[model samples]
Target: MKKLLIVSLGIIVFILLSLPWVLILVGRNKLHDYDIPQREQLIPSSDSKKKVLALFPHPDDEVTVAGTLMRLKEDGHEVVLVCLTRGEKGKSSGIQDEQELARLRTSEMEESARLIGVDQLIISDYPDSGIEDLGMDSLKKVVLNLILEKQPDILISYDSNVGLYGHPDHRLTGKAIEKVFLKEKGKEGFSPDRLFQVTLCKKQVEVALKLSSGFQRNYPENPEMGLPQPDFSVRTQPYFDRILQVMQAHQTQQNVLKDLMPFHDKVPAWIYSRIFDREYFREVK
Candidate 1:
């Protein structure tokens, strides 16, 4: 009886400790790719000078499309990065005050933008993590003004319908851009030719979250987290180093990433090299 009891306790401990990985395996079993037709592969001509505009909610959020933006710039296209907020509400590395944190984040963003080869970086005054609280009409106006000023050929942002983790700021930023996009699209000589929403694959999210830590609140293991079906997926294997450098520039968010990612510095080059190589995008309009 004593031996049996000991064995039971050991089994229970083992099961409890492995529960997270078990859940990850279960979630991954449900992964399935959609049978969507492939869109034309984008190959920019070296002389083509397409103007691209990218809108994101925070300083670090730009990392989502860093590789794409870098490729566009290298191909002779101009790219502009419009950050909605300074990431004042983000987890702090060492700063105590929100204003100081915002300042540091802005500096980091500038450095990242320069290195990523963006032509311009625009910073908005909206409160960090408070985008949805603002009136939609007002947000639309702000985005519209920028779109009118820039006259970009392509616009990229997060998908409002299905955010990576349903972040309110990300959803709201996408919503505002959608409204402005539709409004300007019908206007004469004004709308962008294409609009793309950066997204993640279901299988990729499942495996990544399994390896990550401290993401329960942000990236719950919900089916809605991934794009229903991606319209296009860009392979960015060649630009992995560029994207990593861009993410590293957000010094204040380094600790936060490390907490979420299993690798030291929150990003192991080999792991992300495989995971982020394929970037998904849905062309909404």
Candidate 2:
């Protein structure tokens, strides 16, 4: 009986150690299982040459809407990326010094912006993971000034209310943008015609939660997590190659990329293309 019990314990330990590899295998297979034909619906048309501004807290945040940016550029609209920080405070191996990491990340971000067809890139001085420490009034002012200067027709950012598992920087940057939008939208002076908050579809969130606890453990206990009802979605599968290229640009964030997107080299190109298959956004204005 004791021998059987020891064998069972050994089996459990082996399974626990192998669980991550198994999950990645399952995730890759599941990517191919999605019905691509059913997801090929056309995105809404926008006027030619419209200006767009995306505000986010970190370098890689732009990946969330990479395909949308590609489409906007293809449509002849001017797209700009404004990141709140260089993501210098992100997780890093002991090899690279902090300064070196920041420089590498900044370069990666610029390359990503270029790949995404961003005509302009504005990186602010706010510290990574420390946007909350920046006063609310200051945060709003910084974003407001950019909106006024750019005079964009569209603004996009993370969903402030939920903030992709409640990262403080993500939450603060988004809330700042939302506050600016609410206060200035249709005001006598300057404002973007519309504000769109990017969100994870329920399925994506559920998958992420199941596949990795990194994000799930950090999600705040907020009812707002359930709130971002998407008003529209962009079928980004057509621009899949570009999205993957953009993600690859941020090589310093390989771990993050792996976690945020269940992609691997072994997966077929068609299946991996589903990485940025759909991007959901809710119109706040």
Candidate 3:
């Protein structure tokens, strides 16, 4: 009986030790199930370095594309990030005051941008969770003015359709960028070569909703409503370690991040990167 018990205990320990690797392998296979495009075919080719600008509504919203941004920096492209709100309304364990939370979140974003090697980090004081109140014309004007000042070769933002789970601020940010794109399109010197909207595959949305109640609540009621189909995907495996560091920089938003990526802090970076090796984007026509 003693020998049998020892064997059983050893078996359990072996399983426990092997579980993380098992999960990582499963995740890698599942990701491969998606019909992702070839990177060479989809990524634009340019002889000279280009400027890339990303606009998002809240501080931690940048996390969605952190890896891709880092890859862009490594490719010798100039990357700028514009955050429209400080994410003060976001829930944090110890932070109770909105003003104090705003400051903390702003600093967190600054750290994140630094880690991502962004050339410029622009934080605007638009109301948290109240971007729609700014009105369509007002928001469009703001986005247009930024584009004119930056003259970025590529523009990035959330998908206007479902906002990657129907966050109002996220949707509005995308809308504003779309409006500017429409206004300046075909104008010789004013238009960007492409506008890429960050999006998740249908499988990703399903997985996120299962993992995070926050995502479930923010998602649209209509069953058909979701992000547009991805036009391309960026392979972010090379920058995955830096991506985790960027995420960690947003300390104030750890609760939400943990909910979305439960094993983020627990798993080895190599394992984590295998699971989240790519980010999808839709090109706005």
Candidate 4:
């Protein structure tokens, strides 16, 4: 009985130690699993150039779709990035003063937007982490004015359903964008060809929650909530290296990036591309 117990414990330890490696090996070869037909080009083929505008509550929020934006630039379309806040409330390694931190983050966002080939980068002073407090009408009006000024052919923002992970700021940003889009779309001088909301596959969300305890703790109810399903995915494999550069641009947010995407720097580019080759989005109808 004693020997049997020792063997059982040994087996359990071995399995626990081997699980991650086994998963990695399997993931490296399973790229075909993600090769769905619905994974299509983000920009439709056209002779006329189009302007793409993306809005997010924070500076680093653009990281999720940076590759897609790069792709837009590569395809000869204009890309505009509007960050509603400078991420003044974000975590900083050494900066203690909120104003100084905001400045640093804004600089970082400028570098990131430059790397993504954004033609116009707009940073607003709306309080970070306090977007919802501004009220929906005010938010809608601000978004509407931006849309009117940019006259972008495509509009992008966070999903209205789960806001990618139930963050209140993210949710409010999406809500504000959707409200404006619904109310003013197709109107003269305010028409957008498409409205796409950034989202994650259910499986991607599950993996995120499982990998990062911070994500789980912050969004404890996320698993129980329904997220907007991805209508299509943008193939970003070609821009994977540029995406890494974009992430690296946010030096102050390295800790947050490491927490969320732990394997980004550990694996080779090819391997990382295999896993994160596509950015998912839901076209708001």
Candidate 5:
């Protein structure tokens, strides 16, 4: 009787100790996947030719952030695109092989650029699906060089952490961008301080969470691990449409997308109106 009681007590204690972790795990699982259900309002900008540079970790990131860029270009910003990786590991519909997929995505980006009126497209041969592996020193070297060469009035990239379980490439690029900026800011000279990036806001986080919950219902990959929610957002409708078009360009990830987003017909207009836009640096005068 004593041993049984002792064992039961031990088990109860252990369960009690793990209660917090279990609750956290369950809460996170509820938001395993999601998509942006809305669009942000485009803030007004000067109609002059403002220089802008966008650094993205993969082909689709550029497309993902497409709507806001569209607004910037429409506002007369001179836009430049820098793709950090070829996203060779990414899939495409109709295209069966890796080589073809890469080619198709590149072409798709070209189409995206044409639609958005981006003035320049630059790509680094960093391994596809391998941006998270970028070495700090190497990234710093490359980013610094690009900063000098582009001389952009504004620099944009992934926020420190994307609200959803972030893509490794996106997180790495975000960290690398901050490192590069910190290393270059106000130093002897690397042109003027025209660096900025788009960020996810709190309202956006709420939306992303709701969307992710829906996604989890379809594909229960890993129980979700919730991160910081968004607090800032930008709106770009036309760009959001373009982003959808770009996503459509990638057919293989249909399963992933299916899990992460709502059917187009079911998505609400208010969600569209409140879409999360890119977060970036403030334009230096």
Candidate 6:
């Protein structure tokens, strides 16, 4: 009877503590990608001569590059956001109607664009769920048209291994984009002659979170699933009010941001500003 009691206690303990650790371990590995090495800190210099184009899988991807976009725009570099989809599945609260949700997501994205002073917002007809491998011909055509229209000097998009972080759509989009970027690179008439990826420094994620107003709160399983800091970053503190304002515009993603959390929200604004860090890719010319 004593031995039986001990076994029961051990099983109970594993069921509770062991389960959480398993979740903490495998859950994190499955939740976000940790492949990219985040080491360098992005430092901005004088005004950049390059006009940058950021390609986002969804509306919120823009936030990942928000600081860089804000700085680039201020420094005389034109910035445009190309949202590949309307982000229809982002119904976190689960109260919104599906059709209404997609429409609302679009509106939210629009509001975000306005806050960023972004001149253009492109929403592709690609399905909300799968953008990476869908009609390559159609995607190429869409991207090609944007190249002609925006004439960006640089192109930015998700890392090639989008799925490592647990989102299949992200990876597929990466694949599709890789094809499109390769085809358009240096091809006459395609604007934005270069390409870059949105990366974060593993070491700087804490910094990224601080600068980002604590975005990406839930996926802490592998906080490293988050991208490393980009090699080049901009200080948008001068325009942080605008940054915070735009951040609030993403109402759907509110729960995802950590700053909105209880304890973090209480911190002073100056401190938060010091912590913010954002980065992205620059395609090889």
Candidate 1 ranges with C-alpha deviation above 4 Å: 1-47, 208-215, 219-226, 258-272
Candidate 1 per-residue lDDT, tens place, 29-114, comes to 43324453322233346435788999998998877777777778777787889998999988658677999999999999999998
Number of backbone-clashing residue pairs for each candidate, in the order shown? 0, 0, 0, 0, 27, 26
- The C-alpha stretches of model 6 lying farther than 4 A from their native spots are 1-50, 132-138, 204-230, 259-264, 278-285
Q: Point out where model 2 deviates above 4 Å.
A: 1-48, 93-96, 221-224, 274-276
Between the candidate structures 2 and 3, which one is better when assessed by TM-score? 3
Across residues 120-225, which tens digit of lDDT does each residue of candidate 2 receive?
9998767887888888898999999998898988888987777776677888788888998887888866758788888765566667777756577776556455
For candidate 5, write residues 39-61 as lDDT tens digits: 24233453346677788866656
Per-residue lDDT, model 3, residue 224, is 70
lDDT of 5 at 71: 76
- Model 3 ranges off by over 4 Å: 1-22, 31-33, 38-46
TM-score of model 4 relative to the true fold? Answer: 0.86
lDDT of 2: 0.76
Which regions of candidate 4 deviate over 4 angstroms? 1-25, 28-40, 92-94, 220-224
Cα lDDT computed for each candidate against the true fold? 0.74, 0.76, 0.84, 0.82, 0.59, 0.60
Candidate 3 lDDT by residue in tens digits, 59-105: 98888888888877877889989999999899765788999999999
User: For residues 82-142, what per-residue lDDT tens digits would candidate 4 score against the true structure?
Assistant: 9999887886577778999999999999999988889999999999989888998898988
Best by TM-score: 3
Model 3 residue pairs with clashes: none
User: TM-scores, in order shown?
Assistant: 0.78, 0.82, 0.88, 0.86, 0.67, 0.68
Better of 3 and 5 by TM-score: 3
True-structure lDDT of candidate 1? 0.74
